[model samples]
Structure formats: C-alpha cells, structure tokens
Target: MSDSVFVGIDVSSQTLEVASSSELKTWQVANDAAGLDALVSRLLELGPALTVLEATGGYEFEAACALQAAGLAVAVVNPRTARDFARAMGALAKTDALDAKMLAAFARVLHQHPERERFVKPLADAELQRLQALVLRRRQLVQMITSERQRMRISHVAARPSIERVIEFLKTELGDSEADVAAHVQRHHAELAAALASVPGIGAASVAVLLAELPELGRLDRRRVAALVGVAPLNRDSGQMRGQRSIWGGRADVRRTLYMATLTAVRHNPILKTHYERLLAAGKRKKVALVACMRKLLTMLNAIAKNGSKWDPSLHNA
Candidate 1:
C-alpha cells in the first residue's frame, strides 16, 4: 500500500467506483453505514495523500464525513467542473468506471490542495441545519405557490379547489418556517441579527438569509467577507478590452439578499447613501452605483460583526 496515494471516487445513487494509482476498483453496496465502512477501509489501506470527490447531494455527504472521521484528506469539488473536465479529456460518454478514471486523472493533474475544502465547516448544531432547511423549504413552497397562482390566473379551469387548498397549506407552512427562523436567529445570533435588522432597507428575511448563508461574515476580514458574498468588484481586462469591474460567483443566496439590501442602503444608510449619490453625480450608472453600495454594505457588515458594534453613521462618515 502506497503511503501517499491519490484516490478518486465516482459516487452515484446505489454504487461507487474507486480509482487510485491508475488502477480502478468497483463496488456495489447499499448507500448505508456498512457500505461506507468497507470503502473507507479499502482506501485507508492505500494511505491516500488526498481524496477527490464531487457533490452528489446528501448521498455523498455521509461518505465524505466518514472518510474525514477516519483521518483522510478529502476535498469535494463542484460536479459541473469535474464533468466539464471529463468532457474536455474526451470521456464524454458517461459510465461509473469512466467517471472514476476521469476523476482519478483529474485529481492527479489538478491536484487541488485539501485547504480549498476546509472553508465550509459542517453545521455543528442540529438546530442550525433545521433552521436552514425550514428557510429553504419555505422558499421552495413560495415559488410553487407563485407558479400555481400564475397558472390559475391564466387558465380559469386550473383554479381548482385542490389548488387553493395546497396554496393555503403552503402559506401556513411558510409562516411557521419564518417564525422558526426568527426564533433561531434570536437564540443563536441575537446581537448580529439585531445589528443587521437595524440597518435601513434590510429586513427580517434578508437578515435570515445572511445568517444562514454567510456564516463566516463575522469571522472573516471585511474584504474577504465582501468577496465571499460576491459583492466585491472584480476587474475585467484583457490586453486591451479593459472592461469595467464586476461582481462574480459566490453564495447566490447572500448575493440575492445583498442586492435588495444595497438598494436600500443607497437610499438610507448615511455613508453609503452619500457615496452612492456622489457616484450618481459623477455620471455613474444607477446599476453601477447600486453595486458599489452592495460592496460597501458588505464591508460595513463585516466591520460591524468584527467590532461587535451597531451601525454608526458618525463613525462611518469619519
């Protein structure tokens, strides 16, 4: 057994393919404890230097947790990135063995350091997960209700009593879920939540999104937190194109929440509002000014979290 082998596993609903040192192994086991244990033992024997895996929803989370518990270095990369690489390498035809091989080779060539995966820590409290789940479920239910209502309005026949009953139930569920989120926020993040809520234009829903999505907001530095939320302006330039700065990928939920918050901040938050107005006076586009406000708000939130203080207009002006 090599002391530093690189192992890659292609995980699916009912089975997994393991590859290491250019050798492939297949396993057909239930997505349960026993199956995961067997796979872990086999990989441990190889003493892998790193394990590269892809997100398979909740199915692979347990296996990844098991591997981590056994003191293995594991990193889960975006599945789309992995699949794109597979296609690039001409492994376009999908199969468990082929994916495993592609993943192994991907690991060998890309060699992503495990540190990249260390950023998102698992939720330690069951309550945090429950709160997040409720919030997500509520959002899903709201979208469903909206679509149903649109359908009902368009086709009178579709406005059946059954549809109304489901809509009513969804409304009740959303209310209950929202209440749960509020209670969780008060219990776990009282001061931070209050500080966020006190800001003009920010509301309970946006605060909940921030608490749930950007868990590292308070822990990280201002610039780092802004970038994490995808509000940090990034330069776009090529030899001569020299495009304007723009925001890019990060937590979508945080970015969505910030978008609304930024609109409000430009209108109310004294410092941000003045800065936004100045940009408008300088002939900046409204959208451009608004995005700048979003970055400013994120930076301010990080500072507020770090300092354990509320938003102070005077200090902001200084």
Candidate 2:
C-alpha cells in the first residue's frame, strides 16, 4: 500500500465503520472512547495520508477531536457534498460499510485536489467549542420559547398557564446562555470579538455567532469567506443560457445572523447604506440588495480580522 493512504470512518450512534484506501478494506468498532482510541491507533499504524468523515451532527466530533489531537490530518466534510459524490459514483445504496468506502474514496480525491488544503480546517479551539455549545443552547432555548408561546396562544385555559411557565423558563435560560457567550468570548477571544464588534450595526449576538460558527471568517479570501457564509452568488450558466445566480448552502447560522445585521447596516451604517441604496437604485430587488450588503459586510469583517484592524468605514468603503 502507498504511504499516502486515505482513510474514512462512518460514525453512527453506536459504532464506527472504518474504511481505508490502502487495500479497500474496512472494519467496525464501537463508537466510544476506547473504540476511538483503537481506531486512531490502527490508522496511525497504517500510516494514513488523511482521514475523512461526514459531519454526522455531533457524532463525529469526538473522533475528529481525537484524531486532531493525535496530529492526524482529518477532514469533516459536509454531508450533502459527500452524498452528491456518492450519487455521482453510482453508490446510491446505503450502508455503514458502504459509506465508509465512499468516504475513503472521497478523502482520496479531496486530498489530491489543488484546493485540498482549504478544506482542511482545524477543529475549533476549546474556547470556541465552549462558545459553540452555549450558542447552540441559546438557539434551543429560543426555539423552545417560540414553541411554548405558540402553544400558549392556542391552548386550553389550564394548559395556557403551563405553557406560559415553560416559555418564561426558556426565556430565562436564553438570557443566561447569551451572558455565558459574552463571558466566554471576553475571557478567551476578547480581541477578535472586539475587532468584529467595532463594526457598526453588529451586535453581541452577531459577534457571538460569528465567533462560534464562522471560524474561517478571517482565514480566507473575501470570496471564499462570502461563499463559506452562503452569501456569494453562484454561477448558473449552461451553454448560452444564463441562469440566475443564487446562494444555496454554507454556514446557515452565521448567514442568518448576518442577514439581520445587514438589515440594520443598510439603514444606519453610512457606507453600507450607500451600498444598499446604489444596489436598489440600480433596479435590484430589495432582497437582492440586502443580500449583497450581507456579503459586503462579511467581507469587511473578514478583512478586519485578517489585518487585526478595527472597523474603519473609510477603508472598507474604498
């Protein structure tokens, strides 16, 4: 087998199905700390080029962190892109072992690609991980509060009181979650957070989401940053038939936060307000203008992060 052998592990709630490119071989192990250690040891023994896994929500986190801590090159790919690759290769049938094979092959191609290094983002730092957890908890609390509010409005007289209590409890939790996010950022990522927050129209919530979700914010080019956040316009040209360019997928959490911040920026921030007005006066729809502002805002933030520079409208506008 070549020294540059790619490996894949399809992680489920109970087991990890591992596959390797060296000899197209695979095996299964329990999805636990012991199994993860075993898997890492086995792959290291094989001298892998890299390991790949689809981001199965939180299932892949432990293994990824384990591999990363072990100094292995690991890539947690988007599930949608992995599935599309499987479809392209006529591997439509689904099974853990099969997924392991597909992922191994995907890893091989991904590593060989010119831009492979761009896909190899380091896992979040411990502080960022903690921030991510708090942010996600805040999201859950917000969702629960919303659900309870809806239920309270349409519930029986007795049920209304119970739903209201739940809503109140969730609201309290949400506030605390936000506070934890603030304290964590101040303790660990204060400078980065401050640089981003210095920009007009960006709030604590937006800064928290960016710090937690868009770790690539300052690490890439403006175009890559925008695309990563799902704000870039994608081409849709076929022969001579030009189709509308639209964004489809990226970090939806950061994108959603940016959307709201852009709403405010387009109205108040001098530079962004002018940019928004120009787009609108150019006959672009209000929604399209707003989305462009989102990209512009993100790109500016990316620059600010990269240069360790605080927000300056003059530089950004120019």
Candidate 3:
C-alpha cells in the first residue's frame, strides 16, 4: 500500500498541471481533448491509487470526467478543502505546479479518510451532464435578467429602453432554458422527478437542480445526504468552551436551492410546517429554526428517494 501512487491535477481553462506523490515529477498538458487523452494514457501507466483535483468552477469537470472514464479513481474536491489542507500542511505558496503537488499529498491523505468514498464516485452520465448544463444555463439567464432589471431601476429614462430590451431577451432565453430542462427531465428522469415533485414545496426548478447537481441524494443515508447539502450542523467546541454548532462545507448551489424550497415548504407542507413551528416554540431563532426545517425536509426527501415512495401525509407525518 505504501508503494501505491497518488496523483493531483490542477485544471484551468487552457492547461492542466499534473503531479505525483511517488516522485518529484510534475508535468503540464493543454486542457483540450488531446491533452486529456495524453494525461489519461500517462496515468494509466502510473496506475495511481487516487487522483485529486479542485473544482475550479466548470474547468475541472471535463478533466475529472475524462479521468474517471479512463478507469482512474478521481476525486473532484472543493477548492476550499484543498486550500485548507495545504495550509494545514504549511504549503502556503500558490502556483499551478505547487497546487498540483499539494493536491497529490492531499489525495494520499484522502484515500485513507473514513468518508473517502463520498468523494470518489462516478461522474454524471451523458444524460445527467446535459441536464446539468441546461440547469446552469437557466441560472445564468435568470441572473442576467435580474441584473438588467436592477439596471433599469437606476438608469435614466433614455437608457431604460436598452435595459428593457436586454431584459426581454434574457427572459425569452430563460423561458427556453426552462423548457429544455423540463423536457430533459421528462425524457430521462420522469419517475424520480415525479416522486420528488410530490413534496409540496419542491417545484420543477428545485427538482431539476437536485437531479442535476445532487446525483447522490437518494443513494446516501440521511446523515450523509444532509451533510452533503450543508444542512447538517457541526460542533464548534474548544478545550473548555463549548460553542455554537453551525453548518459548514457542502454543495453551495444545492443548499441555496434547498433553502428556497424549504421556505415554501414551511408555509404549505403540513409536516414541515408543523416541525418548523415546533422548533420555534422551543425557543430556536427564526433562522436556526428554518435551518432545522431544511435538514428535516432534506431527510424526508432523501427517504422518499431511497424508498421510491411519494410524499404521503399520513406516513410522513407519523
């Protein structure tokens, strides 16, 4: 096991910096089809035990997926996690080569972690990948519309026409993106989407986000799923001082969508509403209580997905 190799790849729009833990060797390749194939072939020869890369927005997705497809054990971790590991190891310098080397060390540690399997899973398939792209495009269009609307509020009367034109265009694009998302879900994940939508607060948008961004929602246990979505609270205790427990790292995009859905759930979903009110009655703050509701709602959804069941008021409430 000590003789096993570990790899790290620092991915960018133009290049990928590669490193190995077994030696002082490091290399770079273009971030294109040819580069990815060459990197895969080289790693196949090395046969690393694990490969780690930071999630640099969308840049790392292709490299990670390509490596995974080549039968490599790839872990696409959050950038914050990798940075924190580097800081802990006293590797504070930042460069593509240095980052790659740090990631190689991080990969070795992560390979032995108790929760390692959580990071080392298959990337989304082609269908889910397409759905994810559409989902992200919808988000971008919504942002553009929002920005245009805000600009309209501050723009002079003469500039209003241009802002309005941009807003209209963005809205049209948003609608088309939404339609694409719906069609993709209906074609590929109708059953799962229908089951999730059975929950009162979970609308089509939320369902699409979950199916695209959180492929592990149903496969993981309640605790794992909650933690993965950043709803699970963590202890902030010290040697003699017990501090507040707060949620930490997880999928931010998923958490945002879940939080929005939870707000609606607390208002309309009977079970969630009751649970939320109960927490408030117990003297929890509004935000705290709301977070609790998010965790509960997530766990409920997790159970529904795991059991292939729809939301049943009688059973769920019980």
Candidate 4:
C-alpha cells in the first residue's frame, strides 16, 4: 500500500486539479458530468491509493460520489482544516493549483484518511433536505417579519404588502415540504422518528432536523452524538490559565433547536427538571445548568435511538 501513490484533487466551479506523489495534473473543466468523467478517467490512469478533496459547499460532493462509485477511496475534508494546514506549511499565498498541491502534501505528511464521518447518501431524501432548508428560510423570514412589525409600530413599513405576500408564500411552501418529510419518515425511519418525538420537548421541527442532518445519531454512542452536535463542552485549560469548558463548533441549527428544546425539557420533563434544579441549586449559572440539560437530553435521545424504546423517565431521573 505504501508503494501506491496518493492523489489530491482540488475541485472548483471552473477548474479541477489532480496531484499525486510524483506528479501534478491540472484540468480546466466545468463541474458537470463530462468534467467528472474526465477527472475519474485521469485518476484511474494514476491508480492512486486514495483521492482527497476539500468540502467546498456541495461543489465537490457530486464529483467525489462519482469517484467513490468508480471504486476509488475518496475523502472530503473540511476546507478550514486544509487551509490551516496550508498556512502551517508556510504557503500563505493562495491559488487553486497550489492548494491542490498543498492538499496532497498535507495528506502525505498527516496521513489524514478520507473523512470517516459518513452522511447517509444519495440522501434518498432530497425533499428532506429541501424541507430542512425551508425551515431555515422560514426562521429567517420570521425574524424579518418581527423586525418589520416593530418598524411598522414606530415608522412607515417598507414594502409591507410585498414582504407579507412573500412570507405567506414561504409558509405555504414550508407546509408542503413538511408533508413530504412526514411521508418519507413514515415510510422509512418511522420508529426512530416516533421514539424521538416521545421526548417531552422534541417536536416535529426538531425531529425533522435530526432526520435531515444528523441521521447517524441512531448509530452513535451518547457522548459522541453530543460532541457532533457541539453541545458537549471541552476543557479550557493551559499551563497558567484555566477557564470553564464551553461548547463550540458544530451544526448551529441542531445546537440552537436542541438548546430551546432542552430548556423546555428542563421545565416540563420531571426527570430533566429535577436535574436542572439540582444543578442550579449547586450554584451553577442558568447557562451552565441549561447545558447540562442539553447533554442529558442528547444522551436520552441516543439511548432511545439505540434501544428502540420510548424515553424512560424512571431511568433518566438524575
């Protein structure tokens, strides 16, 4: 395997570049079926051990999928990590070609394997993705509507009728999207969805987000699920300074929805409520108490998903 060359591909909307241990190849091609075929062919000629690409929105996903289908080992890494590696290598100046070379070099030096995180794919649920996106847009529109309403109270509303119509249309579209998700969930992940909704605060929206983005929750251990959602805190300590652990860097949508749900859970779910009160009585700040509730909620969700059971309050009591 060591004798086999590793290939790094830097993919963009307008160009593609392939680099191996011994040589670099660049191709100017659109990101389409034709370009994808050409790149796969060239990669086949190299017979590289693995191919690496950075996650550029959804720009590289289709191409990566094509390569994977062709029986090539492909990994798409977070672009931030790749860029940081580039800076650490002292290649500050940026160009697509250089980034491609740097990606290959970074892979060789770090031995970073293709992202082990697997998203359930072909996603078979483009409608779920669309529905999730609609929910996000609805949230944004609600914010806009709120802002506009406040503005109307104080001054003249700007294009109020137009904005109102847009909001109404979005709401209607979101309703259809919701129906699509419900239909899909019923057909496939019905049990998981039912188990998730059995929790006190997990609602249709929360369940939808989980199904669309973090469908792997059913397979992950408790702490791992929390960490992936960015609700798990990390130790903040150093040689001379120490700070409290804080949660950071994961899907903001999941984290935010879970935060609100956890708050409601801590208030209404007896098991979580007692736990929340205990933490608060121990002099923990409300924020810290809420985080603990969030962790507990995630643990319960994971347990339910793994065990295929409803939320058990008796077992969950702190």
Best by lDDT: 3
Winner on lDDT between 1 and 2 is: 2
Candidate 4, pairs of clashing residues: none
Pick the winner on TM-score between candidates 1 and 2.
2
What lDDT score goes with residue 265 in model 3? 98
lDDT of 2 by residue, 1-318 (tens): 346889888989889999988765689888899998898898878777779988887898899999888988899988888888899999999998899999998998998887554454457877778898999998888888888888877888978877877778788888888889899989988998899999989999899999888888788899888877789999999999999999878778888899999999888889999999999899999999999999999989999989999989889989
TM-scores of the candidates are 0.83, 0.95, 0.94, 0.85
The models' CA-based lDDT, in order, is 0.76, 0.87, 0.90, 0.75
Q: 1-318, model 4: which lDDT tens digit per residue?
A: 567777777888766776777675554556889988988887788777667788886788788888888888776777877898899989999887788888777656545434344211223245566655656665665566677566546754666676567667766765776676677677767888899999998888788777776766768877777877888889899998998889887667778888989978987888889889999899999999999899888888888888899988887763
Model 4 residue runs over 4 Å out of place are 1-4, 24-29, 47-49, 108-162
RMSD of 1: 3.4
Clashing residue pairs in all predictions, respectively, total: 0, 0, 0, 0
> Which run of 10 residues does model 1 get worst, by summed lDDT?
115-124
lDDT of 4: 0.75
- Please identify model 3 stretches exceeding 4 Å from their true place: 117-122
Q: Candidate order by lDDT, highest to lowest?
A: 3, 2, 1, 4
Count of backbone collisions in candidate 1: 0
Task: State how far residue 254 of model 4 sits from its true place (Å).
Answer: 1.2
